[model samples]
Target: MTSEVMIQSKFTKRFSKALMSLTLLSSLFSSTVHAHFQEIIPSSDIVESAEQRSLTLDLTFTHPMELGPVMDMAQPKVLDVITPEGRASLLGNLSLSSQSGEAKRYQASYQIKKPGDHIFYIEPAPYWEPSEGVMIVHHTKVVVDALNGKANWDALVGAPVEIEPLTRPYGLWTGNLFQGIVKKHGKPVPFAEVEVEWRNDGSVTVPFESYITQVFKADANGVFSYVMPKAGWWGFAALVEADEKMKNPEGNLVPVEEGGLIWVRTRDMK
Candidate 1:
């Protein structure tokens, strides 16, 4: 062939090869992306027996974005529990701890009252769709049995309620006493008392009379605050008095009314 003819033929072959390679790479990447999005983790197979009393489920998710990019939209995954018979049992709403680092882990606890085979499904994405584009959905399932006895049940069902510290932004560190008030249902009743307790060496003591510096009334807002001389794990509870109509003829509050517990901790004071 002539020199120009040979050169044109070689250019055509090179272009064809490049096009074929691009097609193959596109097909392979599309298949891989589909598989990754459709993947589901393993499910639990523990059967429910009489011995099993409670069930606990822990879930974690990782996003491809950085912390600063999705900080506002970052939230905990939602967990939905459906009984074996196809009834919604427990729905937990959780959020990621502000203290969590880059991995972004959120946690929540659920208490199973009845014994049965339960199926849990979690969605690790936002509930509402954005106007811009649709977000990827990650879902998984698990089964649980509640035959593990009361202690095990409580371990899964009951957790220590987290209490946040109450402190001013900047304050002097002085050995001083503080007073707190408690109210319920927007009214202040006389019998509404608050008790402060603490624990040391696994022994709990009700030191309200000694350590409690003062007492105040819960205003119309039903709010209170107290300052502790020392820092430790402290518990507080309030006595919610019954309504006036429920009182007896002798002006004594009824006994059937429920009480309220107000628990908080002071991590630091400035």
Candidate 2:
């Protein structure tokens, strides 16, 4: 080959490699942002019989829309249950079980003895998100109705950040509108950003990548609403910065992204 042709070929190769690297980074960042959801899914959302008393919870940090790239979840900082009776610690019940290869997941099985609501909440270990240049702590929760429970789903679970459900939060049909108020420090966080997504069961195919996670903001009253588009589990996460800063693995103090997450399930009334 001619010297000029060889030079052009080398430059083309270098440019292609650089472009590929940039594309990968962009894709990774996009996936990382939407995957911040902290999931505490249960085996059942409604307990109706003595034979099905034990409720098993699946704990993980993942992108519900994509359903892959499951992030590693360390031991949770907070895991408890809130019932009409009162709040009690369920952290002792979480066993470090492996759901998939090398992905650390926590699972807890609780037997429902009462005929009310059981709210399972978790404050996961702060995850360091290098792409966003910050740490993320998603205080997540899910409610299970026991024998047609009451509307006690609006209780303040005392998370650093939380979502107080305005909807019934349980026993909902698809296409129902679910609403909640974002709260931090027991007060309203108006105009907060809430990211919404559904747990994909591999049957969904989004027309565009951006459609994987939907982002919306709460109103001035700290209230946000979303309609269930399909029959499955839906998650809402409201993000706010913590007043305090924590040191990352590199020993530099960084701001913490506090995400208040709530998971609710809907079904088609077939």
Candidate 3:
């Protein structure tokens, strides 16, 4: 073959190989499933002194482990704090957080006046996840201990689906085994599926895509447990399909992924 023809043939071969590699990488990444987590993280899980009485909560919808491609969060339909006293709406306190990208997030400030455990919860607007072909609704909550009063840490916020913490949900060190029962409509859901993820604050490097979200299931009576290996925020989401389907943006019926999420923090023993 002529030199020019030979060179052209070699270049074509190299180009074909590169194209194939790109296609393979794209397919591999597309197959990896990223778990969605609704975060309602508080500034302090426990308030001991007068200086710590005021607390701030950050609300966002995103892949907590992957950290991004944050989904836009609309104004929540309901935001409340439940305590032994009663449920009080905090929707008015929520304000838009200044974040990059078009996706919106929220924040709220609350003063811990009384001494008790306060469960702050949110019923976010349904998010349409086209990749999953479903609308996602995650009702998420976090507990804050006020003035050293730790009573009723397991109080339910009356979410559609909820996790009643078997553990205290706060004041813990790393490697602590956190346990909770998944409930739907105030009843235990036998053998429910739960996805857990650590809120990546750019500290821990994820080894693999699968490591981003840990998957496990609840046994009979819908109880689940996990020992957090890192000192940071961890979210447990128990997901179940609702009995009724909802219309998608295209006016087609799609399944609703109803999730009950709870957030807890672990600190390194000093």
Best by TM-score: 2
Alpha-carbon TM-score of each model against the true structure: 0.29, 0.93, 0.89
Off by over 4 Å in 3: 1-32, 99-101
Candidate 1 is scored at a TM of: 0.29
What tens-digit string does per-residue lDDT give for candidate 1 at 1-270?
999999999999999999999998886654322211111122223434534334444344321111011223244344566553444523444445335455444444455566554445554443222221223333333334434312111011110111111232112233433333343443443434444443222333434433322334444534455555444333344434233323333444333222333222233455
lDDT (Cα, tens digit) per residue for candidate 2, span 1-270: 999999999999999999999999988778566657899999999888888889899998888888867789889988999999988888888897784577888899798878888899998999988777789899999989887756577787899899999998888999999999999998889899999999989889988977988998999989999998999999999999999998998998999999999999999988
Clash number for each model? 9, 0, 0
Q: Tell me model 2's lDDT, rounded to 2 decimals.
A: 0.89
Model 1 lDDT-worst window of ten: 153-162
Ranking by lDDT: 3, 2, 1
Q: Looking at candidate 3, what is the lDDT of residue 191?
A: 94
Candidate 3, 53-141: lDDT as tens digits: 99999999998887776788999999999877788999889999955667899999998878889999999999988767889999999
Query: Candidate 2, which ten residues in sequence have the lowest lDDT sum?
Result: 27-36
Local distance difference test, candidate 1: 0.37
Pairs that collide, model 2: none
